[model samples]
Target: MLQQNLYNWRLVILATAFSGASALIYELITSRILLLFFGSALTSLTIVLIIFLGGLSLGAALMTIFKKRISSTGLVFSILQLTIAFYGILILSQFINLPKLFDALAKLISSPLLLQFTGGAIFILIPTVLLGAIFPLAIAMIIDGPNDQISSRIGWLYTLDVLGSVTGAALAGFFIMPNYGHTATIVLAGSLNILAALIVFPAGKKLRLAWLIFILLFTIVAGLAIRNQKMYVIPKNLATIKDPYRQSKNIDIIGQKDILWEKASPWGVITVTEEETELGLDKILNIDNWGQCSVLSHQSESLIADGALGGKPEADVLNIGLGCGFTLASVLNNNPHQVTVAEINPVIYEAAQFFKEYTNNAIDDPKVNIIIKDGAEFLRTSQEKYDVIVIDIEHPMIAHSSPLYTIEYFRYAKEHLKTDGRVALWGYMSSDPRYLKSLVNTFKAVFDNVVFAEFEEPNYVYLFLASDGELDVKTIDTKGNAEKLLESLASIEDVAPNTLDNQILQKYFK
Candidate 1:
């Protein structure tokens, strides 16, 4: 009997650790899913964290209130684990509808912050609450011994729980989500919860029968989720608060055939979709549902060729992003001595192969040297200076791209440039006046000379160029529109520049 009690105690400790790991894994994956529905803004992240922690607190309070009346904590803890597992699986199955739900909510709720908070609460509150109740119940289960040993037992349980949390975060971020994708990772987390429940089940004929039923139910539902896994592909619409889903032309299309290739990465979800346009086949690259570049889009080519070039014929160039490899191809066309491509997501480089015909297989070029690192990090660490540096990242409002638009980023770019070197950035459609003004001010604050040119062929996008020395405006202004564009930007005054400390750029996006 004593040996049996010792074995059960070990099992209870393991159960506590498993529960902690599963909870954290669920939280991280939940945050990633919310990032899809809510724009990847600071507000969206804060809303998720608040909802999770708040729900946990509420559940713990409720558990404490009811603890004295409960007779069988082992049974209660098992039920909580099973409940979390079942609910998590259901959410993973229904997560694809989040975009449509978000769109519906957008029509009713005018405030963006409130919408994010409400959506997060509605989606994740139950499981997080249930998760919160389990730890205290586990503590109650094992603290049935001497009063003196109870403290050490609680300390060990807490330590194991914390260690499990760290393990879960590391595995989810670095291994599971990246390799297995979101749906599979969530399923794995749910399965861990089920395992934890089994580990803590008290020995009895009736309880054993109940455990068998739970296993059967879990297997059936998990099998279904795995079978229909592809249905949970993240939506490509509603990239930001400024853009709505109904406004997209391809809103009518459904199913997963349109998604040519998709993968989840540490940075974000990298997706390649094919569109049968009137012109031809158009391949688009998207990061976290924000369209990065397209084969048919002239913006990437024009941004590099028209803006970044014209500095030196045999210039050594630095390209920040490799979307569709169009910008890299443009630089290569000019016969640069060497082109250093700094791309964060390696999956993006793989996706660019789909547009090899248009990109001239830029990723395979001998002159191109690929460095898979964050653009700003590369600039801060590298001693190599380039005659021209092009920033082809996504919009400044995006959480991942926000850092590259700050005053500090511009300074890094400046420090990595030669005396006469120039830097170019694609400011996609300066529709928001304050955003444009603040961005222009940020650029002007760092460089001696700043000039911008606007294009209207595919869509309205601005190519901004900055140099320490005088820029050849006559060469860049091929259509005689640079002067008017510069005048319009200069008219807006008293605008504060975006900096690392203030981060004013993300606000203009909202």
Candidate 2:
């Protein structure tokens, strides 16, 4: 009897760990899934976290109220585990339909927040509630007597669960998601839950046939999950455009080239698409399905490089982002003495190979040095001072891009600039005016002399030049730049400068 009890305890512990690990894996995957549908806004992330934790709390409360009615705690625990595993696979099958559901909800509900909350409840909350009940149910099965010891036993089980969660988070982020991709990771996590259910199966001898049937069903489901795993991946956030599913049908008609390279990183979904332009086929780089930069427009690139380099010949230059190598190639046209490009995503650097025609092989140039690191981190650590520093990262509204627009990063750029050097900051002409005002105010706070220029050819682009020394606005005006664009910067009404503490661009723009 003692040996049986010991074996049961061991099984319970193992089951708890597996449950915890699987739950955390679900959380990580669910967070990414939510981001794909809702976007990478802070509010979206906060909503996901809140709904996840709230579901756990609700499950715990339900378990507490109905613990006595459970009849067989071990059987209940095993069933919950199997249910989670089944739902994990089920959710993957329905993954692609989320956008349609979101759109429907948006049409029905006037409040965006309410619509988001409803979506979260359906996608994230229900599954998390199942996950949250495992701990309480496992505890109920283990403790035979002595109500006073219940608290300590719960604490010990909680500790084990947390350890498992930590392991799951590390493995999912560092290995599973990065190496195996999202679908395979979801299968792996669901498999863990199935394994946990099997470990606890012996505790419910009265339901032996039921357990066997469950095992067989779960095995079949796992096989189906593996076979249909391609459908399990989180779809790219193509919200700015049409639905990704529908967009594929229009790709051929539009004559856009098939994706040259694509990678789903911890940062965001990175894709390279080729499109025929006036200057022949040009490659465009997109992060999270938002078109960031491309090598198609020589005019836009020239404007950015000219505004940044300030027509300095044979001067040292630093390009914060190396997207498609357009800005870098344009900077090279001026014959800069040396050029250093910092690109955070290594995938972007790899994708650049396909754009050799567009970039003129500038990445391979002897004078150009490329660093695969975050732009802000590089600026903070680098000791070299450059005559010109160009920050051509994506718009500030993006969660990852917001860090570069902070006042602290602006100061870091200033610290790395030569006494007479200029720092050119890129903004989108189509950006929210409030965000633009905040960005300009942030730059104005960092530098005494700031100039703004707008480029309307090919694409609408905005540029802000910041320097301690006087800027030749007359020269910029002579190049057909809009004077009103510069005047808008000075006429900003009431907005605070964006700082690291309060990233106004992300807060308000989103």
Candidate 3:
């Protein structure tokens, strides 16, 4: 019986899934879209969620408006066309006059709280409303007239739709956009819309030609994106959703040469480039979440770098967050350490190696090793202790990470450090006082001696130098060593400091 219904609504099922995938891709895009300009984890996340659910909600409400009004499959497809058209406009608007719209939104909201609450809500309203409507309308259209067992058929259709949604998301996230680019993905969604309409009301030659025209339009958009150009908004100062949190925003290319690399998620862009360069420095090429490029580089350079670790690590060091292998690369330039780095996202590693400027020659260092895993979890289970542990993940907008910065996580970090080990953490800070203070407080709860430094590069990097023993970076500041380190540290972003001050933390306290 159930299988029969699935057979009946198969076309609609496919269409819904296609639509669902398109919706999700847009949601991912929404989260990271304005990044290059207005990017802060919290702020960007707030906007992304608001726009996403808002559109979903809007879709739901519109479904209520059409409740029981459309009886035939033909009518439903017609409405689907209208809904897609509406979503198309809203989606395109972000890329179209994006800079102006972004600035205007920024201007009207004087309060961060207000801006976050309203801005997020507004951006999502349109699509949420539309996405919400599809399922019910689809069922109504598919029912076999009044004689059709509407309720049972609807339930069965829903099951198929849900399955389709799941499949669509997996395919789009893992494959489609990464290889195809945003414009192509949208066109893909639009094609689904046109397909659904045809199934419900098979179009004649003229209508088919019109659909062909749209495919062409989508092709043109894809070509433009290929040139590394995008129709995106230029934002004002990127604000954090909550005051005093670390953040960054920038557009990343997904594919270069002939690989599948596109914006993956809220984290950032992912690309796969070849590991081609090594200046006689051994290095391991890696990408976003996992990398050990520096271990390789350092083995060759024989230089020592310091951060989260209390002291320079032993010959072999373990690293976290393979961000272009920068921190590790910096380490290699300073010391000759056999480094083992753990990264969570393989896609990131792939991109760093292929699309971005990562080099395999780094791993050529006899001392470097790469592991893919989560930092906190890896630290918990591993029997190894490092002289220097660098925790450089600063993703605040994604809610799951809050615990990593909590005092509880710090306790775990302490346990992993050797008696005299060091921990280095870097975070992005801007003009917001509220966010900066909260960051300090979050760190203070776990460590005993937490000291901070302000870098002068205009991008203020709060360097939290912490350990159980008494250590003052000020002591290391003799001639220009402190200043130079501070200068370099200032340039490095992506952090969450565990040495928060009560006063600083209280500034943003509710």
Give the Cα error of residue 166 in candidate 1, in Å. 0.9
| Poorest 10 consecutive residues by lDDT, candidate 1 | 238-247
Q: How do the predictions measure up, each by TM-score?
A: 0.89, 0.86, 0.67
Q: Rank the candidates by TM-score, best first.
A: 1, 2, 3
Writing each residue's lDDT as its tens digit, candidate 2 over 275-379 gives 776668666777655677766564665566876776688899999887778788879988899999988877677656545566677888999999999898898
Q: Write the per-residue lDDT of candidate 1 for residues 196-222, one digit (tens) a residue.
A: 989978779999999999889888888
TM-score (C-alpha, index-matched) for candidate 1: 0.89
Best by TM-score: 1
**lDDT value for model 1:** 0.77
lDDT of 1 at 317: 92
**For model 3, the run of ten residues with the poorest summed lDDT:** 239-248
- For model 2, how big is the CA root-mean-square deviation? 6.1
* Per-residue alpha-carbon lDDT of candidate 3 for residues 1-510, written as tens digits (9 for 90 to 100): 111122245566556665665566556655545443343445566567766766666776677675755445454554565456435543553453555655677788788656655655555555556666776566654565355566665666767666656765666666765555455555555555655555555346876676567556645554554454332222232221221111113334333222222334324344322222433322333222223233223221111134343244343456666655566665664464567777666554543442123433453355767787777677768888666666555443333344455566677777777776666665444455455445555656577776555543223344555577766665322223545544554555434543312222222322
Badly placed stretches (over 4 Å) of model 1 are 1-9, 230-257, 277-280, 456-459, 473-493
Candidate 3, residue 378: Cα displacement in angstroms equals: 2.7
Alpha-carbon lDDT, every model: 0.77, 0.74, 0.51
